[model samples]
Target chain A: MTDAVSARERILARVRAAVANAPEAAAVARDYRTSHTADDPAAVLGLLHENLADYRAHVHRTAPDGLAALVAERLAERGARSVAVPPGLPDAWLAATDAVRRPDEPRLSPYALDGIDAVVTGCALAIAETGTIVLDGGPGQGRRALTLVPDLHVCVVLAPEQVVASVPLALPRLDPGRPLTWISGPSATSDIELDRVEGVHGPRTLEVILVTGG
Target chain B: MGMPSFPEAAREAVGDTTLRANLRHATHTIRDKRARAVAELDDWAALREAGKRIKDDTLRHLDTYLVRLEAAVTAAGGTVHWAADAAEANRIVTALVRATGETEVVKVKSMATQEIGLNEHLEAEGIAAYETDLAELIVQLGEDRPSHILVPAIHRNRAEIRDIFAEKMGSWGRPAPDGLSDTPAELAEAARLHLREKFLRAKVGISGANFMVAETGTLVVVESEGNGRMCLTLPETLISVVGIEKVVPSWRDLEVFLQTLPRSSTAERMNPYTSMWTGTTDEDGPSAFHLVLLDNGRTDALADEVGRQALRCIRCSACLNVCPVYERAGGHAYGSVYPGPIGAILTPQLRGTSSEIDASLPYASSLCGACYEVCPVAIDIPEVLVHLRERVAEEGGKGHRLEKAAIKAASWVLDRPNTLAAVERLASATRKVHPKRLPGPGARQWSDHRDLPELPAEPFRDWWRKNRP
Candidate 1:
């Protein structure tokens, strides 16, 4: 701890010495618009859907009533036999799915999550402009590892409410205290000659079901 | 620990056909896509300007933000440590790990840690630090220096990577699967499997953040792979060594950077994953979190008015991708953890121009201004390079006196119209005496790379006077 104390003082003193003559605020000329102009919320939602698909995330839109059915259909399509489900997720969200639901509990190891076919969770928020879904492990989103280890992830976004037009708009709505995971698309890598090949270490397949009715 | 100067190492790298091919293909591919991605945004220039301003504001008021960040992180139950230099950082980190009684640690991809050479220091103190990033793992296993900032092993192609994995992975941990091929997917799988066990068992995790919020003490790491997530979540004790300049005044200020960084670096709308956490949480990720604020050479760099712009760099490799020099000479030529255009400016400023390598770095760039063009934060790297060049000449005495005298004489002659005209006539009369190649030591150095422009037959000024009024 003493190591930190001395280093802190010395570093701060040096910093003070260095920037002493600098302007008081150097107030950022934040003239940049917060987001692209798309005044309509519906247009924002459409942009989110389009951008999500553009980023290669499988995007599907459905009413509240059809949400569970879409989830079930998506699981079937992904060939998932078992799904890792967080406890706080509404029970009805998975009522239609025949895939065995693996609820979050103690003794859930990273190894077990790896064996699970897919992970289904509700995101904290989604960014329309960048085509990103953010999961904070709040209710529906299980531990970070649950969504990560599995080969596929099906994230449900409550559009219009959970979606924002841009990153600036999204940051305020989200809680910083919680561990936030902003996913633009499925796990991807451009490591080889800048050739983007989706599906790497994280969930290779990302499916976003936009539940607009709720 | 022994490394050669930039000119010394870059000479070999320049002649390396394989490294050249790898860098050329990678840089060209990323550079074109980056342009298209950047073009998609209509307000890109505004965003870039805002990014620059935000960083300037933060750096100008760095002391205030740092103290606020320390308080916020402490309030959230995370301890913050300060390190004045690399040795201090290493000592504090090693002592923390030893106190935990852990012999091994899993690390997320972190440039700050790499810059401080933490892995070697930890090893010297009998602690094994595992690098889990796919590219970093390859570099570590192959015993190679990182050539590029984003992709540490950019000098190595897929086949070279596969061979490194096959030959070296076993001694480290889980060996690459039998008969590993050169495919990117296969290589990624080998890394995932080899590093997963280490991730699960390790009690200690080390990382560097992309941005740190002063308002909430939230540390954010923007990455693609799940390895960062695993290290962030699974470990009981997490240690993050971040540069002092990484902090922003507030979360709202963070908005400007998040927009520009991804597009500039990887040319993506958004990177695959972004992790943000505030100190420690109960019954959640890491119960114990430590933030090590590093100021190794940052204060020195900040003291400089013209050189301070280099600190605005977000570690995006866009400048490197677009740099003609970097595409040929590769990363190792910079002779520091950072490389390419950003490195050419940053390394010299941080390390000072005393070392041969540091002195050589200011001359590494062609001053083409491609780096300044694509810089998200608008770091004027060429300006800093020229600034550092003056410092190197004045202090390091690397600039030759003959070149200086020649430039002074040319200025004296050109300053007077009559003297300039007389000299032009003299040069035209003695054109044959000028020779096809310079007769001094410069002849060999000049002919080795390129040809002289035949002295242009006659000076442009004389031709203009004779033909026109």
Candidate 2:
């Protein structure tokens, strides 16, 4: 066997030994059941909506063709004037809106991003069961900071790209060398008295754009 | 520094009624909120199980995963340094800061950094380290060590915080507003203003990670306040010191932890700001990023089979909130950067049960199993505590030897029932002369608080012989 294969085998053997010796391994392994059940894109999107609402995150859906229009109209409704746009954002996505589009640049400071009215980016991956959108700084996702700084963030999730799967399945798709941010919901906290407060540090408003029939 | 003895520290903590009241109220509130937040999701149990499995699996193959992580991080234009101990870690970090020619560095609340006393070390090297996290800032300004993991200033009430702010906020940068009151909003405002100035001026930033993904070489930090974001993004150079055990196998594995950690800790469904970065991005955030992979006592901790599981802790502080002993003793009594149940097990293992403090830490818990029930990673804290008690008994030598001799004599006597009966009769004859309290010096402390059970007039064995047995 090659050295790499030998190393892999050795590591796997050690892991097997460790697991066998672990006091509660059998019990824990039996409890970890795969939960993915959505059949198609529409099913996945539906699950996302259910889970998001369950987590108290505001969710919005629209047709693929009407996405830009819907996003523009949503931005307008929210009184957003300048939207931070990721570098790989589709130009046509923002074409319908008259709001000033601020391209996400490398040197942009948190203060600058805070000044922008809103941020729009494409997700690297989305887990439907948890209503989580992961931004990996890949293509339209831009830098992690861009999505974080602004008070309002609108994330675009393509129907087929998002999955209703377990973390084990999603593991293979992600690159280890990318800046990955997994966001379940908008930033929030509860004080010492158990009073829940939203938008303590990250974005106050998180609007999910589910582009269907893509 | 070594952990102090648990019984002595706990005795001191138990006597402070005010501290006890504060801790009881604070911990109970967080524990209830955490329970409610976790209960909201039906899949919380599954998520917790998944988290435990992932962490266990990753830790099992930690060496391989760490190498993979290093390669990934190096490929992504980041440098990874391995430090076998705290001194090594501090040296590497101070060297990095010195190389940058910066006199001051802004810091995120990193448990690893605190574990090694990096700030004090940095100060000794003539470099100033400013804590940017609000709780840490309060700790630094007040010249106090953190007592609680999540809320370091948890022991201090709002009025104390207001006083700390009013007195120290100006020296840092921005002063507390003219009429700073003991209100959350006012304190938060003062902290925000004070930290903003430091964030803008600092040339370097230091931090710790909640999780480091090996597959992607991505470092993740989840925080409630925006201070971490500022410290991470504002500095020209970023340095993160993270424990080796913090590495997860993959980004997907992060899902399990992300779900369980927030609800268990800060009682949030999700933290406000979860910052993740791979490496240096051209002109985005910090141009330079360096990761210090700290081992310190981890390899030593990993050596023991039963004791190693303490490493799986994500520093969520859930154990602290639920600990009855920690609720009384507070954080300062523990002496180590880690406090409470997790601290009681972890500190001794890391530092060894050599000192008065380290030796005593194992006995700090009531072994109520509340900590085990709430632990996200399912660390059997009571099991570890008992195991450490054995270790301490072995280390102490005198007690174990005496106990062994007494056990041997009892066994011999039990082997001969007639002799046992005779001895029991003699004990009953001498019962009137026996004192209620133990006669020994140390025995007084135990008897002072608790009454020794009265010896029966007739031995149980004698009664059994006379009756049906």
Candidate 3:
């Protein structure tokens, strides 16, 4: 086979040759707003909560102190026996839970993650207009598989801080070097007769804990 | 061997009542929801326009952006390879998998891979490629071609899927439960169980991206199911075969597309899962990453002044959902990986109109203009179709020459007032002798489907004179 350099040079040459005399692209007119709503953090959080639930994700609100209890209660309510915790997750957040905690220190294998019932992670940003929670595998967020293979995902969003009004606002705050998984609702499909059915291969139930600092 | 042309294949699909009904029901359901989803955004027009501008700008400077993308990806610990066409891409991907010494690879649903016939190529090289998406799993198990862009098996109803699974599942891996039902939830559950094993065991993963950010070197795959997540993260090696046109300039430019794509495709404010990765991270996802930049016929399509706008398509399939031709004739009729109005204009331009199938594609549309209205990038599909039709006729044959001469004669007689009136009188006088269908040649195909209109008994002028006098 010919080497990579030749292929690279050839393909680029083809592109340059093709567009040599093509019309210059017009300037991008970004007349769209950054935030569809006003710049109020609280209102953005409210919209985020409403939009998340509109897509059928179970949404809840709590303060920093109540987070451990809320996470424990939500896990128990789902009858979950084990929860996967990312390496950097705060131990105190799950201090109140009786379920076995599986910390992903060396990275949980897919088989290992499969046995866990829920995963709890912090997010990079949440877009309110789209009801999306973007996880950049930051502190508290582990590998992408940890959130994916589990039957349920309990994501912790730092309200007012993590919430952005729209996609434009969310992109600037995120670091793209880290892997990002944006969960709008749980994994769902509209494939069968175009009927929207939630939960296929991803987490069946997504419980979002909006951590508001009082 | 030559494949059957578009009209030849379309005739079969259009005549199938079951396929027609299935496509009609599926397309109508998605079309209504897509309109509702698009109407929710107040800045949708601006968003759409920005999306077009961003794509146009990227295409205009594709070589520069592609070079920048390669450097960024390599800097972030991902190896990049460039493929000029399908065979080269398949060879690169196959060798990458071989290097890992693993035979089985899991795949996220990707149009680029399908366009290159990667699965078949992989199979030829002794690699087992498993399609992890639900609809893809159905099509793969049934040994069928994908009909629609988003929902590949839109031509198959729930019952047909159950039958495919119940019959084909045992040979692949886990068997479907005895006497499987056709319920959507139940079928989804079966697929979840059937594919989960492959996801857990797969050594190498393959995917195609929705958007590739050139500045950040980030690749994004927006999907409804978590199957993509499994293939992306669980595997040891990751290879993404992305079209060169999938690239955008920056993260800032990505915002406009993220807003428009989901609403236009599955008709949601956002899809269920959107995965973005720049390169390999420490024990987070894959240890090694290979970015295969594919330029198979994309540059050829990009060279067109009017038709290059087809490259602006994000594969949203909004046009497919509203397309009357696709709803009735179904996806397989287009005779390529891409189907519907976008396919009609794009398939010809990308692959060229040399083949009988590609040539027939331009005439597939009724020039109804519905596809243009709903197009996110505002591709003037009808205008491109007419342009392509001219090219097809330019490759003139005896039939076309006759067609041109006949049109000229008709126009000449119609232009003269006396000659036009004389012909009209002759037509009404001979109304009783006129055949129900054109007797021969020129419009035999047209008259086969439709009856010639009855002579108005008298041409309008004759009736007007008799009534007023």
Cα lDDT for residue B383, candidate 3: 91
> What local distance difference test score does each model get?
0.87, 0.78, 0.90
State model 3's lDDT: 0.90
lDDT score at residue B369, model 2, on the 0-100 scale: 92
Q: Candidate 1 residues B1-469, lDDT tens each?
A: 3567777888898899998999999999889888988887888998899888888888888999999999999999899999999999999899889989999999988999998999999999999999988888889999998888888888889999999999999999899999899989888888878987787687999999999999999999988877788789888899999999999889887788888889988998889888889988776778899999999999999999999988888998999999998998999888888999999988887788777788888889889999999999999999998888878767736554665678679889879999887787777778777655556686667766776665557788878978996
Q: Pick the candidate with the highest TM-score.
A: 1
- For model 2, the superposed segments whose C-alpha errors exceed 4 Å read A1-31, A36-81, A91-99, A105-107, A128-131, A157-173, A189-196, A209-214, B1-5, B15-18, B37-62, B200-202, B250-252, B281-284, B397-469
List ranges where model 3 is wrong by over 4 Å.
B397-402, B406-469
lDDT per residue as tens, model 3, B197-311: 9988888999999999999899999999899999889998999999999999988997888989999999999999999998899888899999999988998988888888999
- The digit string of per-residue lDDT tens for model 2 on B353-412 reads 777888778878889999999999889999999999888887754345666577679999
Please list the Cα RMSD from the true structure of every candidate, rounded to 1 decimal place: 2.3, 5.5, 3.4
What does DockQ come to for candidate 3?
Answer: 0.80
lDDT of 1 at B398: 53
lDDT of 2 at B384: 95
Q: Give the range of the ten consecutive residues with the poorest summed lDDT in model 1 chain B.
A: B396-405
Q: Residue A61 in model 3: shift from native, Å?
A: 1.5
- For the predicted complex of model 1, DockQ is 0.68
